[model samples]
Target: MNKKLLAGLISALLAHAAHAFDPFQIKDIRVEGIQRTEAGTVFSYLPVKVGDTMNDEKAAAAIKALFATGFFKDVRLEIDGQILVVVLEERPAIASLEFTGLKAFKPEDLKKSLRDVGLAESRIFDRAVVERAEQELKRQYLAQGHYAVQVTTTITPLERNRVGVNFSVNEGDIAKIKQINIIGAGAMSEADLLDLMVLRTSGWLTWYTKNDQYSKQKLSGDLETLRSHYLDRGYLEFNIDSTQVSISPDKQDIYITINLTEGERYTVSSVKLAGQMLLPEEELTKLVQVVPGEVFSREKMADTTKAISERLGNEGYAFANVNAAPELNKEKRQVAFTVFIDPGRRVYVRRINVSGNTRSRDEVIRREMRQVEGAWYDGEKINKSRTRVDRLGYFDEVTVETPAVAGATDQVDMEVKVKEKPTGNIMLGAGFSSAEKFTLSGSVQQQNLFGSGKHIGVQVSTSKSNQVYSLSHTDPYFTVDGVSQGFDIYTRKTDTSTLAVGSFGSDSAGGGVRWGLPIAEDDYLNVGLSIDRTTLKTDANSPLRYRNYVTTFGARSNTLLTTLGWQKDARDSLLVTTKGSLRRAVLEVSLPGSTATYVRATYQHQHFFPLDRRLTLAVNGEVGVASSYGNKDLPFFKNFYAGGIGSVRGFDSGSLGPRDTALNEAIGGDKRLIGNAELLFPVPGMGRDNSMRLSVFMDAGNVWGYDSKFSLGSLRYSGGVALAWNSPMGPLKFSYANPFNKKAEDKVQRLQFQMGSVF
Candidate 1:
């Protein structure tokens, strides 16, 4: 249609202006002035062929077609004695595009953005398109709060009818919000309302959150939050009338004003159940959160609807619809909500499809699933399955969806998609510290061995005080009933002769077989048995306590060890935990047949409470006790030790225990107690980044020997600040602490750091 319209205009121009001539029959067609366009290409666009009668209309159409190709800047037609001639001047093509002062964005991204706007290298250059490209660059800067951004486009002619385009940008400072005014907020304090918004005036943390920057997207979200805040507080008729954002003359300061009408608060008069009461009305009534005489809350109303929907979903109604219909009385300032539920067709899972397991086997992920195919659709089971798969630690992400089967109303397909991560790790580390002197360690482990959901690891370490070599393997699903089995073999040599501990050395070798039984969701019962032989080595410099033990128990002894443990973990994440509790208890016993018989038990409980979106309160407690059995004494080596990173900071590792007064060396103890409280938050100047966190912590712990009296006053206390980073290699932690009750004999290390694991 555009071609025909252009043709009619061209025909009128030809008749009234130059090239006005009588219709003639063409003998041959010839093209001229085309530098790159082919003659055949021109001929194809021409409506009139060599044999067609040449008229004003056909001539106009031919010229219009050639011009519409966008290849030529100027097109003309002439006749040389009935041999029609077409003349063309091709448009200059873009040879290259370059950007200057591109710090806010990548050059490639800008190039792609220009390409999307029809301005790229090797493409025909149009002045209008270049102008649009300039506007696009400015728009990009504006979105980033760069209101004073300047963009200048330059076109440089090149050889062969080509051009080079350069976009010079000067991105100015980001416009920061200097003030936020909430007009017509009567029920709540304006400051309180602003506190609920993400966008805010410049403050201490704004440098990290960038909440002071003027952003349309942030403003929209803030508005929604403001609305929700009011609605959730019983303001049923709340409305945001207008929002005004203005910038200063220099464009460096932005001011935002939100005008909203906060209607009268309303109370719930009654709550009723209506529509398709598939379940007992009395049972469904328990799901209603709103009660009579209570303030009306949209959050409670929504929760009620969601609960009803999930309950129906558990009954195979996969597409249930639940809504809360509210009736308001302006005179009484009261509202009543009637929860309506629609239970759609009963559906069962037809098939469970697993995808995105590039390295892991299908069954490796499938075995974690609790939702069974051919069973009724159960929302709880499906959610549990997703959580279990995620807890495998083999995938970066796991998602599950149940979509109705095509052409089958009663059936749905369960789609479980997972994004796998590197499940194998190899670490080699060397460190030189004043306390440990020189140490070297290395480990190679494959958590998902050969995509079989098995684990295998080999570890080796050498240091001035200790040397260890170990091998371990685990099959998570040794049995189809979700029982796990593993085995470990290791040899360790400890030389405390030069250290703070009692000057004694010991060499040991051990092997163990362990099994885990899943007692319930998130709970496991572990049992293991192992046998080891140890040879104690001591010299004259050794503490009298250690030498006496060696003389009494003999230099060499063999012991059979057995372990039983129970664990329950309900954390939201294995790493970056913000909520839930982890409780574990383990008991270790040397059997009666062993050279030394003893029982050691330890219990730990750690809980994380989310104070808000950005803060968490974590508290951890641990207790350990050891006792002799069968008329035997507990081995000194088996004594519990506390202090340092995993216990109390500001104290040396294994230094907070009973000490041999003659040698002034800690000898560990049979009783241990530790407690920690921490406030965890994001690292300052790194908003919303979960990869790192900062914590302020208080630690208290102590250890007591078998003959020593356990007293709370003996406990040591410390306060410190710590930083944890989830780096590319592993989790890294650093801490600085000051002991509150430091004794002259106590060993203190004010600063400590470690990598590759969390304390």
Candidate 2:
């Protein structure tokens, strides 16, 4: 035989002989069939060595060790005289991985998951791993309601003991819910019960909302919703027996059946207080929300308990626990409740530690914290702090954990962890409205300036009607007492022609210094002083209204402006809110240094109510009046204008009030009144998406000259569909309206849209 062939033959034959042969002193050891793996790796796992006696037990140990490493497909040990030979068939290394026809998930996402399962590129290939990966991929597709999804994995051998793993995926259509049947619902209509749930059968809006899609989590939530629906309607013993979700064999449809038992409806007979009522019983009883002779409501019971606990907490009972115990009178179908209060020790905060702020300064988060170290641990304050931080828009998530400190009985530490979010934005966007054909706008804003709680922004906007440039900076904590200082410099020019006003324009340049003092937890008082020069320019085509205004107020006027404003924002969220009220009032006075002397005051109030988890009702109103302070005519340029998305959507922006003769253009007016009502709801397909919302709104308001009488009958009425989306490019809005009631001269702007801030 050839020497090289003989050596190979000898190694293979002896590799298996050692396991069956008697004991022998091993003089040398040789390994075979290694392609890319280091030889030392194999030797490290091998039990037998050069000086060891190669017996059946040792050979068995060597085989076990090699196979356990998962780097080899097969191994054999043999002994040639005193020399041990190891024969190995290495597992194929994954030289590459590819996916074909994958759409439901990104290729990188699948690869990342594969890496976690030890099945990525350059990893040893195992049959079990391949099967597991296939199953895992199938599971992921199923979770997305793609029951018909098919995943097939193929291992193709390659050169150098490597293999290419290819995953071929056919992501099928999402399984849609065909029907939902709620069984054993008594004392309630099916429509009423179903209305309380988010899941529904396929409907016209399913393509956008996707509430018709099958989701295990959605079903779970729906079941809970059903329970609450019955419980809140006086079904004291509401019980959800079972929920069955079935998918079609071909996987295009899903059917859900929820079994529930709505017990006898009960009414509230009485509410009594029990168990350690530290305060007067009358005070505690006043906190009860459940009304006698009204339907028994679990929601009211929970609210009553929460109110009692919160009341006790306000009195320094930080660890208070309140419970509601119900006593049922079966014959009368009435329930009586007793509230029990447990006021635990008054605990003070030991420490307020903050973490997870890698970029934001510690002070930035601490300033928003309402709870302080060494202060009483008030639950309301802690929760307020969490919400305050969330409202800053500087963090994606904020969490507060109150864990009791060790070696202390009445103290706990507040651990506030915040996941910071990007506060820098570069906005370059455009939008269109019927009034303003196409407007372009851009801005560079940094809300968290240099990890400090400051806002700095520069915005420039240009359109057919208006052009503006503004720069502003605000330090939220300019003073230790939470005073905010800011300044703005801006130049603006507005052409009235595009707005159907006069063929005239006005140019203004100015800057202002402002300071705001935090008067209350959610209130601020602002004072500002500004200087501006207004140059009113007119062509020969200028309307009589504009020419008369310039003749009275002077074409070129310099004014010293003073502003006083107050705001109380108790809204839970700056965007997409359901509760609370926001009230703002501002008064601006053009002082004696200029040709124009006027005082303008505007007050706006907005309130929101959550009709349900998915629906909210909002009402907003604004009233404004401006007049000359010292018997001077109000500046026409500073007049308040109504109409548009913020006023009345159906009318062209600023085109609803007093019109100039001959030009037939709205020149604005000194008095304005606006009111809006909106029913906000979630858009289809976007589940629990707070970033986008759709609303049906009614807008009623108009601008009136100080001489014109303000009457409700004169207000134009319009109802429209509006959308607000906090999209990646910035905030976007769209509206379509029909002026159900309109004057013949009112500018009709039926369609409007905006991207980013138009002002």
Candidate 3:
């Protein structure tokens, strides 16, 4: 006779077996009722082995072990003539997975999500796991504001003990915020308060911004902004009590309500400093920004503490602590603040370790460091070191951390990590016009040549009107004391016969040596010298002034050029600057011995101001003036031109100046003026991505002949919107402009674009 025991009946049946049967040794073990799983897999999980005494306890343990594996839905143990039988009813394996009516998410993305949850093809299927996967998919849709989404699962049995799983999803309309209410905003208007938030009710630009969509995370951030607004305006006891979000029955609209209390505004009664004043009392007192008569501002208080701490850090107190304790007078509606300073132990850097530089040499980064090893830790020096390294353009990211050495209270080690980017690039540029037909230019440059922090470039351009080839090399650190030197060799050929300018041709060859000396942390003094020989070619179509100049100076002329320049750059980034100012002034003078002696001075100033977290206001202006010296005439070809991409938009390139009346073409002038104001912001739907930006700008400028006086009324004006993208290929820029003043003789190009170039 065969005896059997089920897993569920283990406790009850084991009692019967213990009383009626005696213990017997197992002769052999066998597994049954498993089609896909190997029998050896089942045998390995069994607690009992052949030739072991099998009792009621061992039988119950074996059945429980097999059931816990999740591969089987039912398990049983049987005995027949001293042999043990282990039977398992294996769960169905998933054969095929499919999805239908899915629009919001890609099929592969959903499959990957299922795989992450351990519910994929070829895995044993359980109803509970499938239900979890279904709920997960619904949650994902809800996060995207698809509140009305529907998901249905269908399981169909297939051959060979397998099953097919299909998830049919219908993503409905996205829910949008319909209204927002503030309960206790007494001091501020509702409109004004709402403007400070990123999320809002539906509006014209909501489709692109997606601000109308409700998100738990976005709501939380908005709440914080609301709290800060009142706190910054001297509402010392401001608080948000509660928030409520509700949706319509159709799930297509959402409403939000916030209740807050704005307490009485307080003024600063007095401010004082206490505890361990390391610096001069008067000097530290000047850093306090909170005035007794002014309203108490959290922003100013925070600024005061940070400034004091940084100042102390510069004095080797790397871990200095500064805190502001405010005493409130509710009766008088005033507050008094005492800033407490704690100067920690003086610390020196024990070691500096560099990492993440896979290609650049250690010295390439080390030389840029302003903080030296074994020196007292100076916060200012460390900040400068990080900024200098980041400005190298060899790395995408640079980070520095100073952690206290193990078991050492006054010692720390600095870790400088860098993420290197591609330093070599091959850039190609092309331009098209009616006169030139087509022009192509290319450059091959390595900014960090051989990991030595040097730059080398080969540039070539070809066209019907102009051709240029140049080679340049620069060593940023020619001398250890931060002096830079560079060499350039170039030849240029220009033919203006097919262009808007006066018809003429010229061939020139020259080379230059330049040097840069660091005068300050952000200032540089530049000096350069060059010699060039130019041969002029003129025909009947050339302007009278041009032909006369060529005849007076002969067909060929030689000149010695000297340039002196001063530059101060405080921009936070070279690629995408949000704040800071850059000023550059250069003077070029030709010696009296040259065929043409002239002095040209040009100055440019660019400043950026951050309007908010994601917006910047940039103002730029440039001026250039040239005059003859030693009774020599200024070179005709060296005249400045305006109305171009780098000057004024909505006009032809280099087409603005005094016109050649005979040829009805422009003749460039000896003076130039350009000004631009741009409001820069991130592209909509791109959250905090620095790789791309959009700007609305106003441009104004003009060029004047030597005899003409500078007049504000003569300047051109334009308004436009531009897009800048730092794509994988290169930096790309596009602009569309409308000229406010377009003369009949002026040539206008409303649309302009460039690649592999900076704007």
Candidate 4:
């Protein structure tokens, strides 16, 4: 009876399980909340189709797939008797994105950067994506030293299931470099090590170049430089084990510590040459800047090798190799150098090719090249050509390469490549000189004229006492043999005083031409001749002064002057000059068409002294003398005047000596002297590439009549400080001057500045 009852119960359970629930078969599909996403897209993700059996597993998967598209906030799957329903809450579309309080980056640019990360206007919005973008934005700011940056994001829903997102950013103060310290420098002082670093603590000039701001890339470069400085100076075992950068709790201050190991320094004991010299051994030895008695320096050795190679190439050796091997003496702490040299084949330039100049004419570059085809290769010429191209201000970069000519023995091809940059500029300026206060000047200049390697300029200036208009042109390569030519035409009207109680005004127009003849590879002799016609108006308020002045005066005059001068500039840079020039001119002056002659001679000397690695001192002096010969009368405008911006800055224009009662200004005399000295220093917290400088200058000079006594006590003294900016537009300068020894009568000049000044 128990077995029969159990069998009946099992049969009943089997019958219930078999008829429990047939799988629901889908007959139709429907979707809800289809705003941005189409209903078809929702249906495509569904696992159930018409006539297909539906189960709890299939329904859950379909819902998950739809949600994973990131286009729906909520997804629900439902089933009827034979139909499956896909319900989704589509994400709202973005109408637009707005940003506020952004300083470092533009709003439009920020939006564009976000577009790549699946964020843009009219796109479905997701909270997760927005949060990721906000993090990325903050990271970019922090990388640029904005450690305290704040970012906020807000989303507002609109009608039609659209949304608007706004990002409000606060770009706080930039993190500045507070301190830099060197640790574990066993033998070097902390101050000395810090001096070797390019990154430094904040000080003045922080606002200009912003070098005080911290950057990982800049720090890496500075560390490399520091390492090289030590290693090159005989610290062979020097090592920078680690560098630590720490930020303050407030994220405002930054501290850096560099750990270094400096080894002992070594000196050179002996020097020997190991290779055959195309030139004499003595000649090659003279080329090396390093000596046996000096400390062993890798940089000096490298420079010595380069100099030897350059000397060989200059002597028609196209290829040369120079290597230095050091023999160490442990006991003496000294090293001996054995320099090896290899002079390669004496090749000639078979062909010359120029490229990368899209606008410049081929002839323009070819004419400036010192090395010629079919000639023996010259390294000096090649280097000079490169420098000439660089000085043209037309190219961003210029390089020359020599490739061996296939199948041609002792022949190579020269290729010149150049990258062009903008060289034309327009300038409008207003400035004040003691001589011409309240002056206005404007100019338009083109250094590369029509891409033909010529310079053309037009300038106009007006002042209370002077007016000038001029046009000038220069041909860098006037002839095939490297001669230069310059031409200028100018018209001027001036009212100026003379020492002898007379005021002279003149209207003159003239043109002058100059020809440059190459005296040496780096020197030139220039000759110039000019002719001008002048109408002079003179007035005398003092009878005694007029008596001496009227005796040598002329109403109108025509003059012809011929001048010869020479210049040699072989310095490593133009910023430092050590050169001199002697000029002699013979002038013929007359009334409109009269015959008169005068002779003048002038000499100038300039010298540069390097005080240290960071300081340079310059001194310049000039003297001019004039004498009358074969002319009964001297031209009124021919007299000399001094005591202005170019002369003594403290004194008024032409006010260094006695003034003419008849004229309101100082007069030009027959003899003059001028001298200036300057000390240049780098401003702290500014990079050397775009550096700022502070200068203290002293100027002294005087003008006197030919017969008057020349005395040093008569010289006026003025001292002042100046600021210099090496800017893209050129060197911009501002100076504060105290004229006449800083006396109360000598007030300070508040603002004296200029742009695009050559000196």
Strongest candidate by TM-score: 2
Task: Give the alpha carbon lDDT tens digit for every residue of 1-759 in model 2.
Answer: 211122222234466635335577879888888887788998888877778876556666777788889998888665556667787898889899899998878999998887877788888988898888888889888888889998888889899989999999999899989888889976887876676667887777677667887878888887887788778889888898888889888889999888888889999999888888788889988889999999987888998998999888766677788998889998999999877788888888988999999989998889888888898878789888998888888999999998888998788899999998899999876876666778898999999988997999999888898899999999989998889999999999988776655577889999999999989988999999999988998876887877887877679988999999999998877777989999999999988867889999999999999998789999999999988877778878888888787889988887888887677778788999999999999776455666789999999999998788788888888998999988765788899989988877778889877665433
The TM-scores, one per candidate, come to 0.84, 0.90, 0.83, 0.75
Deviation (Å) of 430 in candidate 4: 2.0
Off by over 4 Å in 1: 1-88, 203-205, 420-450, 456-472, 487-513, 529-542, 551-560, 590-597, 610-616, 628-632, 649-652, 679-698, 708-759
Candidate numbers, best lDDT first, in rank order? 3, 1, 2, 4
Writing each residue's lDDT as its tens digit, candidate 4 over 505-612 gives 678888889888887866678878777767666545433343354455545556777777776655555542323222222333222333446666666676667675
| lDDT of each candidate versus the true structure | 0.88, 0.84, 0.88, 0.72
TM-score of 4: 0.75
- Measured on C-alpha atoms, candidate 1 has an lDDT of 0.88
Candidate 2 residues lying further than 4 Å off, grouped into runs, are 1-30, 46-59, 80-84, 314-318, 611-615, 679-698, 706-759
lDDT per residue for candidate 1 within 683-753, as digits (tens), equals 65454567789999999999999898778999999999999888766677889999999888899998988
Candidate 2 vs 4: which has more TM-score: 2
Worst 10-residue lDDT window, candidate 2: 1-10
Rank order (by TM-score, best first): 2, 1, 3, 4
- How much does candidate 3 score in TM-score? 0.83
- Judge candidate 3 at residue 193 and give its lDDT: 79
Q: Residue 497 deviation, candidate 3, in Å? A: 6.3
